[model samples]
Target: MAQPYRPDDRSECVLAFEALEGALRCLKDDIARTERRCQEVRRAYRQLIEVAASDAELPRVEPDSRLYRLTH
Candidate 1:
C-alpha cells in the first residue's frame, strides 16, 4: 500500500535535493584535489628522469626486468 501524496512530501523532496547537492559538492572537491596531486606526481617523475639520465653510473635496467615492466 502507498501513502497518498501530501504537502509534507514536497518538503521531503526538497530535503533530498539539498542532501544530493551537498554530496555533489564534496565529490567535485575530491576530484580537484586528485587532479592537483596527479600534476605534482608528473612533475616529480620528470625531474627524476632528468636526474637519472645525467647519472650514467646508475645500473641500467634490463628490458625484461620487473622494474622496467612496472615503469613502462
Candidate 2:
C-alpha cells in the first residue's frame, strides 16, 4: 500500500523543483536525439524501397499517383 501524501518544507520543495527541471531538460535532449535517429532510419528504408521498385520483376507505378507517394 502507498503512503499518504505529505507536504514538503520550503527547502525540500525548492530542491524537488530543481530536480524536476533537470529531469525535464534531460528528457528533451533524449527526445531530440531519438527523432534524428528515426529520420535516418526512414531515409534508409525509403532508399531500399526505391531500389526494389526499380527492379524489372516488380510492376511499375505512376510517379504522379497517390499510390506512388504511399509506397515511396
TM-score, model 2 to reference: 0.64
Residue pairs with backbone overlap in model 2: none
Off by over 4 Å in 2: 1-8, 58-72
Kindly list the per-residue Cα lDDT of model 2 for residues 11-68, writing each as its tens digit.
6667677777888999999999999997887787677668877898977667897656
Candidate 1 lDDT, tens digit per residue, 1-72?
Answer: 323345568987776777778889999999999999977876776667668878999776677976454345
Question: How big is the positional error of residue 37 in model 2, measured in Å on the Cα after superposition?
Answer: 0.8
Clashes of 1: 0
Q: At residue 27, what lDDT does model 2 achieve?
A: 100
10 residues in a row with least lDDT, candidate 2: 1-10
Q: Score candidate 1 by TM-score against the native.
A: 0.69
Model 1 steric clash pairs: none
Please report, in order, the local distance difference test score of every candidate based on alpha carbons.
0.72, 0.74
Using all chains and alpha carbons, the TM-scores for the candidates as numbered come to 0.69, 0.64
